[model samples]
Target chain A: MHPADEVLVARYVEEADQAAFRTLVDRHQERVFGYLRGMVKDRDVANDLFQETFFRVIRALNKERGSYTRQGKFLGWVLRIARNAALDHLRARKKWQDLGNGDDGDESAWWDRLPDDGPSALESVQDMEEADLLKACIDRLPPEQREVVLLRHESDLTFREIADMTDCSINTALGRMRYALINLRRMMEEAKRLEHIPASD
Target chain B: MHNGKKDILLHLYGEATDAEELRSLLRDEELRREHAALSEAKFRLDHLKRERPDPVIMDRILAAAAGEQGLPSSTDRKDRPAVARSARMRKVMLPALTIAAAILFGVAVGWFSSQPGTAQVDEPAVATAPDDIVPPESLYRFVPPQPVTPASTQDPRLAWDDSAPLMDMHRRIESMRPEGMLDWGEQAVPLESLPGSGSRSLQLTGSNKN
Candidate 1:
């Protein structure tokens, strides 16, 4: 466990430390955001799920840390919650929600969080072109494989646990990952011209 | 080992505990080249992605876990009015749930006893209801009877099994030539006696052989 995480989890256990909770929020905010963002393939929805995950962890910790089994894998637990939240959100969105709850950034507010600074830092990176191309390829994967890949990359989870989480046999889990890699490689190779441009730095 | 899933494999090999040894083996140039070139691009992506986790994320996780921020406390402080209210709520909810369960049980019992079937749908009959319902009175259920086939006392083919020695003797006797007649020297006299003796012939033919 990271020292920062330990302190926050410990504080979360002891004094209901909001600062410690905030510390956790600051650290994981972007990754969690990016992860959900990638999964739902949307930013605003991802943001909502990310916040919900934190709050749920908060509630659960408050309910009692001891009540949670020491399964020796907290990251997996956290991501499971995140995945569930994202799935729940997707379900809600499909159910045709009204925006009456008061958050206007739905569909109309943002066109791309990719910044207006003329192809941003991501564009400047040597591998940025490759990364984006690769991301697009990853997005093309079958939903099941795509999710496994995203969770594997974006969230730190073991393949075994990913198998368990996804309700797949271990080999099946590994197989999906294998195919995801293969398809990604094929796509990257196909997009070699685009991939090599390195975001045109 | 794969399903076009190079990225995750790369991450797993470099990062997950199981793949540490695998990663170490990749120190070989040929292996690395093979991996990067033709073996798969997914592994390369995974390797790329397996770089150190964002420290900020870990920090945030810890902070949130320890309640360093405005997260709720596990123990309700004795002095807080909220705790008192929650306790009161729990005190109220527990019995409410128990009562609800009891009512469900009662309903289930009524449903079972009023059955329309040939068997008496008595209280005991309702006992066969699932355990989720109240303990049913009747333990009986429509158990199908097991079929029985009586064991035979003995196999009727015993005479055939006992004919092995006789058949062997008969085969040797049939293979006999006048020149080899004496080859059955020890049984030659007995064989002669059998042909001459009516009683022995009758026994050899069997009682029903006529």
Candidate 2:
């Protein structure tokens, strides 16, 4: 069995064992990166935040100076870092505009212009297309509902934890999930209807 | 009784402990239909793909871990108040203590010069304060202790690890970088994006390519 996250963290922090740190990263980087990508809605920015998250974790764990102890779930601790980095990018995206060049004055267009990278490992073209439609539908969800869905589905956090993370009650988090389901069903039905419509020859 | 939506969700997510009850509830035609729809929605959400993080990021993280091994551990972030207290005392109290010592020394020198023994240097006829006013016992009591220079002889004020306070100071200075060079101003997320993003699975799809 794989070592627990806390055990990995303890080894890395206390011993500065590079291999232990690698194991920790391998285990959580995907989840953290996925969360970041979902929040940033861009792959490159997600990668940047991914690095930053681990960097923060390394710094935090190392600063304990060999007396490291687990305070909370290591996944939760790192997720918080990724969430902050994504939030920071989101907060900065509007005013800072283009990263290097300042000329992209339109705030909304930045995310809009990110090209859809298409589907993942599905076998059939139809499955890929359907997955892409669902992805787009999710991407278009109201921020609150989308967040609830992502935190519930992606982060694997309980509704209570999601509520805490989002600064809302458990009931509110559940309600958001319910509403998100309703919206996604509607979007999927709409996509199916559109797909059935006869193509203009 | 209509199953509460929250209960249904909890059961569906496997969070509720009564799996048998949930399974029985789902056997009802109406509840089963509702649950089936919910399951589909959840499946879609779960099916959302993860994009694999780039190898470069992995390499960077490893490199960072290696580099940071020699550096101070950030364990002190939690003990900020204690560190800050020590730092604050050193910054504010040490100088204040030095100034207080200097003032006491200057007062002792002035008082000594005003005594009859030293008054003869200025003018022999000058009347000194009465012996009752300048108590010799009090003068001896006011004498400063001799300074000890050797580290072995010096009294330990704060009996802590010698490296600890230095490490704390280093961490304190390092903490300032967040506001200093690292402050990337004003750029942030759109208010609309505040709720959430697409899904986490996408991070496992491929390289860090957009």
Candidate 3:
């Protein structure tokens, strides 16, 4: 059987095995990128955040490898890193636009800085092809709910780990996930109804 | 089995895996309905597409991670000294550059304040045409004098005229017939296409209520 992720993390940390690190990246990069792309709704920005996420993990590993401790699961740990980096980018970009950069290109900057209490930012993603409907559904979720869903499903994080990462009670995390599912169902139903109506031309 | 929303959610997600709970859940009608709803939601969620980053991005990430792992390739080693030198220069020059920028900024601000013609920084220049931007003849524009009217002299009904369009919109909405199903059941009304409809404002006002 293949080594567990913790084993790979240990090998990479203790022996500085580049291959082990690469394997870890290969293993989780898709999920990480998926989460990022869903959040940012921009391919280039998602790719940038993906690289930044691994770079952060590498830095943290270098600093405390000797005392490295597996927290719940490796995927959860990396996901927390990616989440923080993505949020930081959002917050920083928000701050950047609040200073009034009114250029045409700065339109996205303004919307990015708006409070993400809801998926108000994902309206643009909703207009993309049907393949992106899933993204649009996830984007429709409140950030906290979306985070819980991504962590629970994509990263396979336990509710306990998700609670810890999000600084909420386990029940709160579970509730967010439940709401996310319900919201996604609603979005799907709406999409189907719209699809059934014949186009004018 | 039908303990609460929490239990139903957990059970639907397969987190509640006890045999006894599963057996009880099967027998509870309310819980079964909840389970079906949750299951349908899960199915919808499963249909979402997964995003994958480009392979080139993956390679760049791995290479950068490798560099951090102290497993730099021969090319990296050769470039190390040059990179270090460039970094060193940046560290030394960045502070100097900041100080230089601060001095230049202060000088510019001082010069701008001292110059009478350039003092109004807050007001944007309103150029009449793109090709020729005429400098304003004066710092302040002339305002035509008006005969002042007493606050009580104006017609009070005119003050509420702004509500006319709002009332009209409300009337239109009240007259509108809803075209589709009610209780969207979670599906939001598609307001996106309303603008092209014959009675767009009415449709938007009506559909949004659904």
DockQ of each: 0.12, 0.24, 0.26
User: Which has the higher TM-score value, candidate number 2 or candidate number 3?
Assistant: 3
| lDDT per residue (tens digit) for residues B38-112 in model 1 | 346644555543222245544545565554656544343335678778898899998999999999999988887
Task: Indicate whether candidate 1 or candidate 2 has the larger TM-score.
Answer: 2
The complex in candidate 1 yields a DockQ of 0.12
Best-to-worst TM-score order: 3, 2, 1
Candidate 1: where are CA atoms >4 Å away?
A1-7, A64-67, A92-128, A193-201, B1-12, B15-34, B37-210
Name the candidate that leads on DockQ.
3
Model 3 alpha-carbon miss at residue A107, Å = 30
lDDT of 1 by residue, A1-201 (tens): 555576667775677776766666666655466667666765566655665577677677666343344365556667777877877766665621222211121322212321232232223334555566566565556556667777776665667777777766666666666556656666566666443564433
Q: After superposition, how far is residue A190 of candidate 3 from its true place, in Å?
A: 1.6
What TM-score does the predicted chain A of each candidate obtain versus native chain A?
0.68, 0.78, 0.75
Across A107-197, the per-residue lDDT of candidate 2 in tens digits comes to 2333344324444222222343876777677766656566678777777888888777766667767766776786688778877766666
Residue B198 in model 3: shift from native, Å? 99
For every model shown, what is its TM-score relative to the native structure?
0.44, 0.55, 0.55
lDDT of 1: 0.58
